[model samples]
Target: MAGTIDPDAGISAAGEPITEAEALQRLRQSEDQSQQYYAAWWLGRNRSRHPEALPLLLATLRQRRPRDPGAGVEENAIARNAARALGKLGDAGAIPELLAALDDEDDGLREAAARSLGELQATEAVAVLLRRLASGPAGAGAPRLDSPRLQEPCEAMLEALGAIGIAEPGVITLIEPFTAHDRPLIRSAACRALLQLSGEARWAEPLMQLLDHPQLQVRRAALMDLGAVGWRPALEPICHTLAENSLKLIALRGLVEQGAHHDATIQAGAVLSAMDSLL
Candidate 1:
């Protein structure tokens, strides 16, 4: 069931080759939903700094399709991708449109918007996101939702707060409880947020523990969370993660880069030497 739900939402054209101009045309005026998704993805994928891309992507946020109550996923895929594109575009101007997307009826759209809000580091969104997290995950623990595609985006919201770097006591108080969340992904996300927000190494413990998570996705998310937090103490633990070397390398590189700026104890020579084993 999990495999059935493609992240690209079944649009082969999402990968189809097209000129940048063509991508712009589709993103700007294409009536086709798939084209909209593809266009947003393409523009963001190339990091297109085109002036029109920002407004066009923001405009796509208003596109909505009828709710598919039976299948349970009602998000407008184009809008979700547009949200994702706005994040990659790295413009704070999209924050308003993304904040509006938080209230979208679709769980996936809210997730995308939350993630983009984080990527943009929209500090203003902290309060709104705090409220959203307070509402609880959209599809948690209810077997009836049958959303194998992982409906609850509570993790994304938590991660966004971390990226925004709000260290307020209230923010920490709100996010701390989620560190014990039943789901590994949420737990990792919470731990990562706590560590990033507070600069506390203790928060790194849970994420490192997840290096042993039974599920590959959970473990992968754990790896990402650790790298995002930039905790150099996790260096040795990250070296021992059971994930693929490609993933470990990415995480390790992130750790190395982060340690360069923040952790004086981090020895670049030793860190690169550790990668020798992976190589």
Candidate 2:
């Protein structure tokens, strides 16, 4: 059942050529949803094989079809797939289409668009992405309808901003407030995004503060982001974290990943101790 629901959802496109004409024809005219998905998937996957597929993939996102007529609902599975494929293609040309898709009514499509924009590191899309974060569908302050729909887009929007790597003073100002949002996930994302924007140790100070947040998830996120930024000043705090918490593996992995080897022997002992406790 899982396979049938989305056969190509997780499948990578075959890089071999199927002839540009055939792939384009199938993508534009095929009635079999799988064929359409494969066509777009392949073109994006092996964009070097057929560059023309980029535009076709963009067009597909604009065209809509019904998912369940009985339920009076339309679905753009093809478009959603196309949006993801565009990200895989890594073409800057797709940025405009993806930015427009950010406003799409379909939650899935919007999420895909956000993901692709991040993939392209589209600095131009930053303002629009910020707008979506502020007031678009499933935005920060929107009433929660479906939990995933409400939060997934917000998460993607924050992550995409991070990926864009823009540290403009204005943009940082816009994001700072979210660091204290009532929601832990948003707060977590904000901390990570800020670190991504500014790799300076000073910027990571905020995430270090979050390490003591009341919520475990928030604390974990803070630890992970601290490691991701490789902030050495937090090394002692992370090491101290191992003494009181069961998540020794997380702290050890964080220290190792960041190359904080000042206390190699101590960290090794902590790791062994943690492993022994697990056993």
Candidate 3:
């Protein structure tokens, strides 16, 4: 019975096709290194088709052992792949694991976890991410200059929170604090998140206040988010500001994208035309 098994073939034992349930069982019970790796691969590849497989993969990754510290080579490989799978699956169940991995010492693992959380649109991760932002260089738990790389993961987490579209109560609360962050980049990212979550009327006031932020980029992002929020009346003053400010082209583009017409559009068009003439 000398035969080659297709690497892409479905889970099977002795060439007998296995049901998802059977594959899951094997994934949960298997201790053999080779079998675990194969199970991880199968689960990662078929995560969407078989959502149940996600928990099994996650469980396998979470369980730690002395010999297999953090599941060793097999576990790390599976966990990384499973993170990608969970992203495609967009399963909320993977949120806790993904969030936990956000601080993983390994950059690749942290990125995978952050990305998966984004794909899942897990609103719960918003609080943790906001905390990371507020804690600046001197603040407790802040990323140090020695490990500047951590900032990327932190930023990725913020971007993920924005993409998740989670309207957590804390999201609004974090807005004011972030507006004052020492770092302009963090301030800009926070403004972006606030805009992303401001589907409700509550975001209107905060967004308007952001128009006055000292940083030009923050001001621009605030204007863009306001436009995206489609608060027609709010665009009035912003339109006036854009007409006077040379660096507001991006904000103007956002307003256009949001179909912000009426008096605001008329005014913005005049400003844009004038700017074009000057160019």
When summed lDDT is taken over every stretch of 10 residues in candidate 1, the lowest stretch is 135-144
TM-score of 2: 0.63
Count of clashes in candidate 1:
0
Clashing pairs for predicted structure model 2, backbone only:
none
Candidate 1 lDDT over 147-261, as tens digits, reads 6444347778888999999899989998888777667777788888898888877887778888888898887887777777667777888888788887777777768876665
| Candidate 3, lDDT over the whole model | 0.56
Minimum summed lDDT over a 10-residue window in model 2 is located at 1-10
For model 2 the local lDDT of residue 206 reads 68
Models, CA RMSD each = 3.6, 7.6, 12.4
Sort all candidates by lDDT, best to worst.
1, 2, 3
Q: Judge candidate 2 at residue 162 and give its lDDT.
A: 76
Instruction: Provide the clash count, candidate 2.
Output: 0
The number of clashing residue pairs in each candidate reads: 0, 0, 0
Regarding lDDT, does 2 or 3 come out ahead? 2
| Candidate that beats the other on TM-score, 1 or 2, i.e. the better one | 1
Model 3: residues with Cα > 4 Å off, grouped in runs = 1-47, 63-78, 102-108, 137-145, 173-188, 199-279
Name the runs in model 2 displaced over 4 angstroms: 1-8, 11-26, 45-49, 65-74, 135-143, 182-184, 202-279
Better of 1 and 3 by TM-score: 1
Residue 228, candidate 3: how far off, in angstroms? 12
